[model samples]
Target: MSKKRNLRPEEIAMLQANACMADNWSSVFVPENFDIKYVSHTRFSGEVTLGAFNKEFILPGGLKKHAGLRHVTLHNCRLGDNCLIENVQNYIANYDIGENCIIQHVNVILVDGVSSFGNGTLVSVLNETGGREVPIYDWLPAPLAYVITLYRHRPQLISRISKLIESYSKEISSSRGSIGNNSRITNTGTIRNVRIGSYATIENCTRLENGSVNSREEEPVYVGDSVIAQDFILSAGVILSDAAKIVRCFVGQACHITHNFSAHDSLLFSNCAFENGEACAIFAGPFTVSMHKSSLLIAGMYSFLNAGSGSNQSNHMYKLGPIHQGIVERGSKTTSDSYILWPARVGAFSLVMGRHYHHCDTSDMPFSYLIEKDDETYLVPGVNLRSVGTIRDAQKWPKRDKRKAGLQLDPINYNLLSPYTISKMRKAVEVLKNLQALVGETSEIYYYQNTRIKGSSLRNGLALYGKAINKFLGNSLIKRLEGTAFSSIEEIWAQLQPTESRGKGEWIDLSGMIAPQEVIENLLRSIEAGEITSLEEISAIILDIQKHYYEMEWTWAYDMIESVYGVNLQTITAKELIALTEIWKESVVSLDELLYADAKKEFSLTSKIGFGVDGSATEKMKDFEGVRGDFENNPFVLAVKDHIVKKEALGNELIERLKVIL
Candidate 1:
């Protein structure tokens, strides 16, 4: 923004000789030391201000292009210093191009009237008919969106939030667009009413209108060849390339949508990957991934989900139009070709295989398997508790987090065992025992929630749920006093008390955040009462929930253990603690052994059939070993064995320490 002056008579003569034409010479302004040698064959109309163009840009192979305007038309625009603009088919209008930017061979870039760059756009997520529309803004996080989209019972809260977002959108609305500094746009197509962020790359895009690429210096947004996005807000570190197209979507930080994937009316959060698939009216939470071309995610709410190839769902089974929506809890997976009719609920960490049409609800049965047996939906509860795949997924999510830079919008909880899942496990135990009691224990099959359970499956479920409960409670107890030194049994009893006021009553998973329901309700009440006004306050509270997860977890576990086993934390004896620790140690070792057996299945003879390629059995085994490694030395197997020893030692050490103070 240096001091601008009218073009001198000598500069006007030089520009006329160089084939540059301006409707009114007085309307064109430049800096005191603006160079005129680089302005040629360019048409300027309306008010135009030019900056110094003294630098040359070096291309990939060292070809240099001097910074200047050539073969282009500009209207009512302000050009920054050292910007090279060339080969624009249509005129650039109502824009402020930043310094050190290169715009080449673009079809057009303009702003038509006042634009908000896609903010305050309502995306019909979860239900396309408009009952569950979420107003998308630049700062919309998953927790806030989860509340706004799903908490429609409170109309005032929704209306207030919608108004807040509309106000924000109007605050940023402008009649002109801007390209941030150090950005590169080459071989692109139409870009209208889009605000590009710093260091963003837009190359070979077909059409991008009414969007905001909220890129940053550390995490730049990238839109590559053949991409077309409209009415979208792309957070930082997003990679949308390879002909992918999205409309009416709010893509969160570090998400990847590539390989011709198409998404419409969806809200996708961080670290999610939608490749070669299609999504419609879905609320995809953190790490919800679908990597196959045949996968279609429609009218469902998913978090930490992995949809296998050919996985799909039916939303319009009723006479009414597609009004039914389903909720797949966190950490669930669908096997290949698996399908579920809408209005169903899949439990957290559950696995769904085959097709289900009974509209089963397994929200009270976490870590189970839902399979169609003889075309009847069969539920095997607590089976995924022993799955190595489940453990690996939980371990890999934190490591695979791509939001290494930028403001993380989603606060993800990566724990495999938490109060959220454990409460469901406790309820599952009751549901299984009640089923056994109601329908005699020897029955071949039992029914609950429109799904059948085998007699043996129910028995095994009770045992597994009991063991899992013991393990979780004991783990919480040990964690609360892991490094603290206790002098007497009285001190141990005092330490068992909850330090936080939250975590009592119900616990829930708000997309990726695991928090006590009481606290969440309080937050909503605050919103209802106008105590919480701004989006920043909500975000700050959301972060505080994650920041103090362990403290809140202990409070829930303390009450749950008392309710399950009648072990009162107030007057619990050392002997009772020793017994509980023994039970926990056994459960931990038993589950690890099951995992070890499951890992052995991967290296069995049947698994080696295709490895040798026309060879003997010995060769087949050797080939399998060479490629997949020996089972005994496998990383997961070794880890499981190590886990057994470590749990045993921890239990023994705690017992001995308790004995010292007995």
Candidate 2:
């Protein structure tokens, strides 16, 4: 609370001579060191509190303006020390402007009545007709939102979580807004019921209403150039600029939205990027990106996805409203001009090309390709396991993360081959084998899940899924016994035993965080029982699950190894372990060879067509080499070669160690 004091006689004389007027001079209060010369042509109404103006601010292009209040109208506001307020077209009311802040050319910054500042705003994500409404609030984690949006089966849990968020909204509701210290609001228009944080920059924005910018000194939020946002919460390190329009959204940490991109009723989590496209009623998980003008993502759930130009989806059948939704699982891609009807579920790490009207569900078979030919959907399962683009995407997502400083709300796991996907591969192998058995071996085409699979594709898919499952199980085994030296069968069994027993059943990818399903069920039960009632407690529980991922993962991998390989670890010998290591080495080397061959296709002569236009063949070859370097020396190619060598040496080392026990 600022102390109010009566003005001295000298101060009143100076104020009169400086052309400053107040409705009632007795209603205004100033600090002891306030100077009347710095305040001119300013009108004060209602009860105003003024602070000292002692410093000068250096604007852009080296122009300087001393800290003062000039040509402005302030009502029931508090001005902090060394702040500059100039050229307010209208007035600033009911705001506590902080120290060293700059407010110039702003119109009407106020809180009309009471506002919750975008908390408790129900955003209908994933489904437009509204069973999956997530009441967004500050500090809403992706895992928590996942539960709120998808877990409708547990009504008691959802009710308890909603009540907690509503209670938090009521606790922070206020009638007076605030602009924090060292912030800048220049050339913006109409900010209402918004809370600005320290070190934030709001420039040339058209309008902002009912929101909170959670910026800080470490990482400031930037809202630039004609952006209009309503009922939104922009998290720390976020940048929304270039005429973007957002409504009823929560933009999470380090997200970049610009170049006229518009989003409505969406929830984009940490590290996502959107530009030149439009998103509606979508739940974008970590690292989701869409950067083309013709792309439209509507009524879908996606994560680690890349949308190409002219990619689209239809959520309505023309008979009903936009009520259907789709799920493109993690690490998927859509090629240019591709389309899918809603109520479909695309498998993880897959690619979609062409247009298909039939709704398909391929959740059991991951890493496949869905291509439309002659209006028929063709499913090629497990072929993406050898694509170079998949490998590159997995490698680049962690490097491209832009969240340098902030408390990250999403717990992201950036593994291309985890227990989640590997389990799907195991199921895929079983499905392919079953299809071959049910249909005769001479059958040319087999149909499953509203798609056609060629006979050749089924055999190749079985081979690919087999190799991948072997690789994942072997990787886990080697990691578990990497450093230990076993001299006897009992010693080998002891080393192979799992450290924990919690991850034996199904595992799920909750947006970005991957964990056991049983663990999530236990948390839901606790929430329904009222033992976990606060957002902080829920976040802590999620963090604990992430922290113990490896321990739980090992428990699951041990069971998988026994079930897939038919190896009884309790009675296994050193010779059997050595044979398994050899098989692991073969699988690793085979996959690397396939990736190497796939990379070579990019450097072929057919890819060098337009490199050297109107030139000889020699010149074209030279031009192609200059732009796209030789395949042998490319960075990704070199990494692949190095990976093969390292894996071979590791497998050889482990086999040699096991030979001693024999």
Candidate 3:
């Protein structure tokens, strides 16, 4: 909207002739060249500004509509250039609409009194009864929300951050709402105090009140038919369609909540999809998807999670008043009809099958499974390490991300084998070894935190953990040492030296980002000490950390190199390096072999049972091959086989380079 001049006497008579009524005709101002012919049956009151109507909009299917104001009532509104505002059933009041907007057939759209436009809305995530209330703002990122919701021990830190958000909300609070350029609001019911952004598409929505559709030209937000969102911050590229209702939530970039999905007091981050399900007080991190109507995700914190049909949790207990919460760590999956009593913690990339009455905590274990047998939970630790599904998930996450580059709010690190998970694996190995030592290594009934583990499973868990550690450390080592000539052991040691000192401690996953715990703590301390002032500063720091991930990752990996392999870095020899490389190659090959076998099982005869439903066994085999492809030629299978070969060749090349020192 720009400066406007009052209408001339002839123009006023023209408007009067066109049946346009104004409470104060002197208060109505229009831009130069704003034709009176384009304004008809429009009622204006109290300082309304109207732009020139010189453009025509060619809608989808070639339906053309000239930019004009018809049958619309504007109260203290500023209409931008070339906007087509018609058929406002009630009115559009106290708003500054931007250029090229379309407001058609909408009911009441007004900013009543003071409003923050969904900023400072408290989302009681991971607990319905309001213990962890995350204040959502327009720029709320995943890592910041993670700390605010989970780090309750630091009350002062939370208070400082909360105050920052409150100050920000107050700063941006206004008596008038905004509709950015090229935004479209059509066939809507009511839009009260909602801040719509550039290129936003809001059509046939029942209601959108006190929310911020933070859309942009790069990727627009879409609100479809029968959708209702209140006190929410829907980020760029978000889609709320098909009766999707979100209350007091902050939906991050590229999230899709459609098909009658209901979410309340939840924070759904980037790339999350919720269709036909219900989310209550959950901190749904990046890639958390629940597509079944029967699925109820409540009082839980999850990342990279896939909740199966009828998969649910019990947050209420007879003793406590729905106070319990759970965490299904990143990359975890729940089977259909699975149930977990609250206060359980599933490990990263683990699978949960069947109901478990006993609460289990497997945070120290990264890739495992919890299965029920005879009403008791049986733990298969580190089994997902060799799972074909796990590998495919790790491969597909980066590809599945649909958020455009400019609108990426979540600082996502798609590494399944980061220092965060490897550190958990290290602790798991210690816990497993401690259990084995206490219960005799041959014992069948090994108990760990409300679950039973068999001896064979225990042994396999240790071996798998060891292999994964080797693979991660070797990967880090290669990444650090590659493409550089090492003339001596000193040179190799120099290359392996940590560049940054901050990554030498335990690493934690902040919903999507994996960074050193001390680094995050230092950031919190800065907030607590009032060193860090704004939310933008916090987001910038977190994104910078995400960019420098591999640099910091190598620092963490370097610290573990000596302790895990029992090698002295100061006096390291070429032969020892060669040995380490050989061990890495073996681990890599063995893991690939396990993956190969796991993929082969999917192409087995039993897996082909229903492939050729009306044909013989031979036809079944042929049809299975046709549909699922032969195992050796399948994409994942080929990748696995190629991974083994590439790793082996790289290790051999490194060993050959080391042999030159002999």
Which parts of model 1 have CA positions greater than 4 angstroms off? Answer: none
Q: Per-residue lDDT for 4 in model 3?
A: 87
lDDT of 2 by residue, 439-463 (tens): 9877899998988999998888888
TM-score of each: 0.97, 0.97, 0.99
In candidate 3, residue 383 scores what lDDT? 95
Error of 2 at 139 (Å): 0.8
Stronger candidate by TM-score (1 vs 3): 3
Clashes of each: 0, 0, 0
Position 403, candidate 3: lDDT: 91
What ordering of candidates by lDDT runs from best to worst? 3, 1, 2
Off by over 4 Å in 3: 1-3
lDDT of each: 0.91, 0.90, 0.92
For TM-score, candidate 1 versus 2, the one ahead is 1
Taking all chains together, the TM-score of candidate 1 against the true structure is 0.97
